[model samples]
Target: MKKYLFYVLSFFTLFVYAQDRQLSLAADVWPPFTDIDGEKSILSDLVQEALGRMKINSTIETMEFAKIFIEINSGRFDGSPALWISDEREKYYFFSKPYFYNQLILVGKKGSDVSAASFDELSGKKIGVINNYAYGDFDKNQEVEVVSDLSNQKNLENLLSDKIDYMLVDALLIQYMLTYQLNDVTEFLAIGKKPLLVKSSHLALGKHVQNAKIILEHFDEKIKEMIADESYNRILELNWIKADVDGDGKMELVLGGNKAGTSAPQNIYGLMHDNSYKEKNPPQRYYVDGKLYETWDNIPNNYKLDLVVDSTPSIEDTYIRLDFLD
Candidate 1:
């Protein structure tokens, strides 16, 4: 009897430890957001502080962006930080609520007549873009000459030397290059605020991680709390970037006064249905956990889940109600 009791207690202890396990995070150096300054990046510091508030400990590792995705998909690491959550990635990983927004812009040398008011205007032009860059709608066109391998500094330099006409790059990357790489070159201009695309950066969890659904739920709650308490805005301000609380291209607090809930999930979905929201890849539902549970039931009893309603109904308008056997 004593031996049996010992075994039972040991099993329970192991289970508890597994439930309390820490998560491993992967990322690359993208300044102001994330930069390698010895042990942590600016974004990592904010994430660490946010996780700490929830009493969750995370171990962060910096590596090449490509390798980070590979490791995440292979289940080698828990997930990558600051990556755009897409439908393709949703198949293998669970994503947290978006904490920030980003845009892809076109940059060219000054005095160039490459007027690209729209994506169609760039047809037949030699476009230099990073290899493996998945630009939702932009990648659909077949006429544009795409010069891959422009992710590296030397490759970008080559492109600048007339190797390619224009490059579709991330705004943050352009900022970094301006501050670090092209400090001497004052002739470049990021013409026309024509946002090629906009996406929210999220923290993702691998499919193989146990209790991924629960973990993601916790993360979502934490993110909401952060946003509501102004921690999210404060972090972006501290990092010297505009705060996008609503995940829209415009950098205004759409959550305050008349703008409150303007871009709420329901309203956003309605805009999508009415063709007002022109996202090439629409939002999708991804089941991170091996099993699916009602969204309401997944949330703790102490917390309230906000549900937004639009003129047109969508999955986003519904509340999740978990049904578990007692």
Candidate 2:
């Protein structure tokens, strides 16, 4: 009887250890977002912090971008910290709330004519862009000649070499590279004032992983908590200060830091900042009720009913339930 009890106890202990094994996350050498050798990046840090909050241990496996996708989809690694949602990807993975915004803009040589008021105007122009990247509506425009490259570095290099007229690149990526890696290259390029496209990035988990849904929920909850506690701001080194900047009594989110001299607060969130408000400043961040929105036009009709101030429905009505976080 004593021998049988010892065997049972040992088996249970081994089972628990196996079940609590650290999860593996696949990533690539995407700078600012991820750096394999350095084991640092905004997304990587955010993921680690969220997991740590949940007391979950994990390891990041650096691999090629293509292989990262393939392996994660096959359940070789648990999931990826950064991924855009698509019909194909949704089939094999569960996505969490957006952790980063991918705002894309155009870059060209100094003194070059990079003016293209619309996509149609870009016809017959050679525009360099990252391959397999979704540039929102720009992807549908077949008129412009898009030169695809493997990475942002390659696309930027092509731009500098005059291989392409203008390169469509992520704002954050260019900002990081210019600030850290390629400061000397700044004098050669001109960045567009207006953004060309914007997309939100999410944490993608393999559908086959055990308790994937629960894990996703917990991760998302931790992200919200991080944002509320201003821990997220510290990670990014940006002060997303929340206060009534417009003196409307309701709180507004302003993006700035104490290091830089403060500028006029931009009312980017809520319906008050919408086009219907008739204010000069346009909406920066869009959201409605309980759900955060990528664009004003994408907000649901049900929410629009209560948001219409003059009984006129406009696509620019933005109002996120700030109380929801409380």
Candidate 3:
């Protein structure tokens, strides 16, 4: 009996040690997704919190984009929470399942037609894109002039100046602006209903890092667990929720709110908007009072209470509105 107890205690000790493992990670200074010290970084908050729930601690340092991989490969960092897959990068890193996505949606001057089924439809249009960014199949349409440049800020400046007909930017940035910075942003920019491109993002460990594969596999499992318990939505702190809650083999747009609102989300946001999704008016579900309602129509009128917001509220306001300008 004493021998069996000794083995059980030893197993528990090993389990505790594994759970307390720490990881040193790195990411670039990409706003709305990655920020210095994780002040305003959504992905950083989500990844860090997700790791914490998994009983794994992590520290992610923000650096220049070019240096993120270089430092990881040199063993200065163990891994990165933000990673995009490529043949060259796969050589040095073991990637986790796609935990996040970098989705690019087209933007145009207010009142400009920002509708297109594909890049082929936008032939002859001059579009602004960030330099060194990989836009899937966007280059195939040679007729559309891609004005690649230094940054999104430069592109926005050019777009407002009418230097480019349209600009491609990450959808998360659009959501952030709509929530926190949209008061000035919406006056000039009209966003496309569909995304131009979607890049799958992963948590990756350097090949030289110890227990790289095991850590990645465990991280993936914890991500799904986080989503199931609604902690993922809390981490995002935004109204958009994407998950296959209905188990329909397709994802649904869900709104996180105290009350589900009076109707569907006017401007639905996606974590990764599948390029193939061609629905003109996709439906949005709402989470209210800890219950998931399939639609606003099904919601009881008593539960449709809206959070009052001043029409001209402070920019620091963190409240969410179901209505969004297209």
Candidate closest to the true structure, highest TM-score: 3
Of the two candidates 1 and 2, the one with more favorable TM-score, higher being better, is 2
Against the true structure, candidate 1 has what lDDT?
Answer: 0.53
Tens-digit lDDT track of model 1 for 212-231: 65556556666656654556
Off by over 4 Å in 2: 1-19, 134-139, 177-186, 241-251, 254-326
Model 2, 34-68: lDDT tens per residue?
Answer: 65644347778888899877777878877777788
Candidate 3 wrongly placed segments (more than 4 Å): 1-21, 161-163, 181-183, 246-248, 252-257, 272-276, 279-303, 309-326
Per-model TM-score versus the true fold: 0.62, 0.69, 0.78
Candidates 1 and 3 compared by lDDT, better number? 3
The top-ranked prediction according to lDDT is 3
Residue 284: error of model 2 in Å? 11
- Order of all candidates by lDDT, from best down to worst? 3, 2, 1
Counting clashing residue pairs in each candidate, in order, gives 4, 2, 0
Tens-digit lDDT string for candidate 3 (35-58): 676256777777788677656788
Against the true structure, what is every candidate's RMSD? Answer: 15.1, 14.3, 5.9
For model 3, give the 10-residue run with minimal summed lDDT.
315-324
Which ten residues in a row are the worst by lDDT in model 1?
317-326
